[model samples]
Target chain A: MIDWSIIAEALPAFAEGLKTTMMLLAISCGAGLVLSVPLAVARVSPHRAVWGPVWLFTYVMRGTPLLVQLFMVYHGLAQFEAVRESFAWPALRSPWFCAWLVFTLNTTAYTTEIFAGALRATPSGELEAARSLGMSEATIYRRILLPSALRRALPQYGNEVVMMMHATAIASTVTLVEITRVARDVYYNHFAPLESFGVVAVIYFVLTFGMAGLFKLVERRALRHLRPTASGVA
Target chain B: MLHGYLPAILGGLQSTLAVAATSLAIACVFGILGAAAKLSASRAARTVAGVYTTIIRGVPDLVLMLLIFYGGQIAINRLADAAGWGYVDINPFIAGTATLGFIFGAFLTETFRGAILAIPRGQMEAGQAFGLSRGQVMRRITLPQMVRHAIPGFTNSWLVMLKASALVSIIGLDDMVHRASLASAATRQPFTFYAAVALIYLALTTISILGLRWVEARYSLGVRKVEFK
Candidate 1:
């Protein structure tokens, strides 16, 4: 039988780390949603200049690994004396903020694609009907387009969140004391790499597995109206 | 600093491309086999294929690469020792390629399986009616359609595998990312080097996307529906 006692004892520390993970996840997701919508919109904008920067941003972010991007933002760009003198330095200097920054941008690249695909999937019929009802272009988009695209985007956007959550483990490389860092410290102290990592792994597993379950529930809720037979049966 | 390191980074880029290309070829074999296995009626084969994909998908690629590069080599070396074998060594180059090929094959398996499923069932029946052998039916009827169906997913996976080829640098393969890291550290120009690295990756991906488009056009010519431009 396995030792339940160890896990019980480790619960508090694991919970603390879990909180940090959740906060970082939230920051990345929140920032990502705000950033990605504009990028997605710009990506499909008719104006060349509006979309040009968006294309370059998405291309660079998507092409490179997040580890390098994190290094670039936290270590590389910070190397400039001018940047250090800038007001943004304090925020950039903080490891948490920097990790969030890199993750936010990374998510922006992925979420831009997801949102663009979702926007493409939005029903044209609804848009035509809204236009015929004398809705202004901006109001039609505001009330009709945004809500519909958001609903379409949710499932894939959720996957982006999960990927970012997993990506957070690398933040420890830049000296952020997340779960991986804490586990490394414990491992060095105890000389039991497997045990320490195992403890931390359980926390990560619980987080990801729980998130998966919750997302499935949300997916079912989102799709319930689409399932005519199931809705009628229910 | 840039001039000094250009040759070294260029040398590393060759190895990165070599490993990715070789692994992708190896993965193609595993992908076909895995797709067939998953589609087989045998419960055991399907279950095995499912488990292989599940484990590969759940584990981080870096962690899997580390395990194979280190843990796999240790096991191989120990087996060699116990057998009193000599003059045989586990090469990281071979090991890294195999590990990446193994991981990416699981994804390709999924893609190929989906592609095979997407083929209309009647196509095979029609092939049979034309008196083609089973082999001919697969080769002439199914494989072409599967390739067409597989292109988009295959392109996405190829792009991902190209980026992931960087992780092998951790296991001591002198890939582009590894050389770039050394360059960044030595030059203290992390942003410039990283930005350059990003552009190189973009160039590779752009070239690959163009190649994929050519492949799709060639393969899809007979079946694609006409649309007004």
Candidate 2:
């Protein structure tokens, strides 16, 4: 019942779509990881003046749908003459820029929360010991707290990365020829849902599990110390 | 100014809520069955449930939705043809809800299974010891206690599902997101309408969090909190 001809014809387009999807996933996740570290630090800050705005930003971003956020950046911003006439308008006009911006900010919001939760769960004794060692707060975070928290955050962070990969499908709505968009185009042209969407679904399923397996390897390396020693009781 | 489009947006909000609520109910049904299957003695049932959740979780929701929408329509029509009935058109509402229900059901299955496992085995044993049937023990003891453990996961799923209802617009359902798009196009104030829709979503989520907290508290009435000094 599957149409091999349609799948063969769509191969090049699907290849292009795969590149776009991967680019979206890689760029957003890379940038989001960098941005979220500081925001997460701020999120767990003791002072309201420090963490309050960060909390609000993450809250609003998390509370709304990423699609709405995408539209707000892509379509909504273009509605304003001031924004359109501004120096940033050229970049704003590109769907790539808008998708990158929205996906980065959206993933950053979630990653910040995940990291903050890990930070919050840090044991009190660790902090006390760092203090007793005459380490500065900055030094403590850099040397002790962050390393531990980030290791603990790895599994959840891996899940977030997979989630962000799935989220790139939303880029299709903004005219980006990602995998989902390619499938949609194929569906429209060939009237073949099984060949079009089915192929894309299988591709996604493979990519998802492949990435999950990769994360498991990273966790094994990073979390090795937490595992019981070879000579220890089973 | 909403330019008299506020009412239209509000009307669409009703549809959005309807989709989320109906989908949640359907998901709960699937979730319970899946959880039971996973927890059952039968290896075939466990494997089926395992594959169901793994496949559902691995794929993107939008991909699955479109697959269900277009793919499902074709399937239904072919069945109709075999029965000598005319072409069958699937309603966007039905397709959207079914797809959302199917997708979120996987997540909820995990949630419900964990919740069931959280209950002590002794509770079920004692209920069985009292001469109650397994079904009666499950209904009277396990399900009630499971609610407390399930609330947090359920809330997370619901919020995610609520936001996901926005995707139904892509399939041609006139949800709030679709209405906002219309209003934005007509008014040429895209930011205003989209931002308004976002705020409405925030309000709904905030309200849900508060309401579910109350439900959770109610369920935890007889439970005592552990304190560490």
Candidate 3:
């Protein structure tokens, strides 16, 4: 029932779409990871002054739909004459920039929460030991807390990355020619939704499982110390 | 111009709610069945549910929506033609609702399965010792407690589903997002319209959070609240 000819014709387009999808995923996730580290640290601070605004920011970002956020950055911004005439207009007008900005902001909010939870779960004894060693709060955080929290946060962060990859499909709504967009274009051209979307589905399935497998490998290595020895009996 | 279109945008909220509510009901059905299948002794049933959750979670909702709406339409029509039943037109409402329900059902499967597993094994055994039928045990001992445990995950899924309802507009469901786009186009003020819609969504989520919190409290009435040291 599937159209092989259309699939053959669309192979190159799908490959290009996959490249754009990966680019979007990489840029947004990389930026989100960098931004979330400090935000997550701030989120766990004892002083409300340090954490209140960050909490509010993450709350709003998490509460709203990412699609609305994308629209606000993309179609919404271009509505204003002042913005259109501003120095940042060229970047603002590009769909790629808008998608990247939204995705980064979106993932940062989520990852910050993940990291904050991990940070909160750090053993009190470890913190006490650091303080007993005459380490300053800065040193304690920099040298000990953040690293351990990040290690604990790895699995959740891996899930976030895979989610971000799936979320990049929404970028296609803004005309960013990602995998979903390619599928839509092919469907329109061939009027063969089965063939067009089926191929796209396979590509996404492979990417999703591939990501899951990679994370599994990373977890195995990073968490090796925690694993029980082969000869050990519980 | 936006002032004139405000009513139209507000009207779209009705459609959005209808779709969300209907899909949520359908998803609950799928979730229960999925949980049952997963917990069933039959290997085939377990595998079927496994594949359902795997495929649904692996694919993006938009892709699934497009496939079901467009592809399902063509497939149904082709079947109809062969069966001498001319021109079967699939409604976007049905397609959108079914796809959303189907997609979220996979998530709910996990939530429901986890909640069921959280119930103590001894509780079921105790019910059996009391000579309660399996159905009686499920209803009396397992299901009520499951609600308390399921609420948090259910709330998370519901909130996400509410936000996801915006996606229905892509398939021409005339939801809030679609209305906002129309208003934006007509008013030449995309920012105003989009921002307005976003605010409405935020309000919905906030209200939902409060409502779900109340439900959680009600369900946890007799449960001891552990005070963290």
Predicted candidate 3: interface RMSD?
A: 0.9
Pairs that collide in candidate 2 are none
lDDT of 3 by residue, A154-212 (tens): 99999999888888989989999999999999999988998888889888989999999
Best by DockQ: 2
- In model 2, what is the error at residue B177, expressed in angstroms? 0.7
Q: Write the per-residue lDDT of candidate 1 for residues A17-80, one digit (tens) a residue.
A: 6678788889988988998886787787788999788888887788777776777787778558
Instruction: Give the alpha carbon lDDT tens digit for every residue of B1-229 in model 2.
Output: 4899999999999999999999999999999999999999999999999999999988999999999999999999999999999999999999999999989999999999999999999999999999999889989999899999999999999999999999999999999999999999898999999999999999999999999999999999989999867
| Residue-wise C-alpha lDDT for candidate 3, range B1-229, written one tens digit per residue | 4678888988998899999999999899999999999999999999999999999878888888898999899999999999999999898999999999998998899999999999999999999999999999999999999999999999999998998898899888999999999888887888898888888888999999999999899989988997878
True contacts kept of 3: 0.76
Proportion of true contacts reproduced by candidate 2: 0.86
DockQ of 2: 0.91
How far off is residue B197 in model 1, in Å?
A: 1.1
Per-candidate TM-score, first chain only?
Answer: 0.88, 0.97, 0.97
| Clash count per candidate | 0, 0, 0
Q: Provide the TM-score for each candidate, comma-separated.
A: 0.88, 0.98, 0.97
Name the runs in model 1 displaced over 4 angstroms. Answer: A1-19, A180-206, A230-234, B84-90, B129-131, B226-229
Return the TM-score for chain B, candidate 3: 0.96
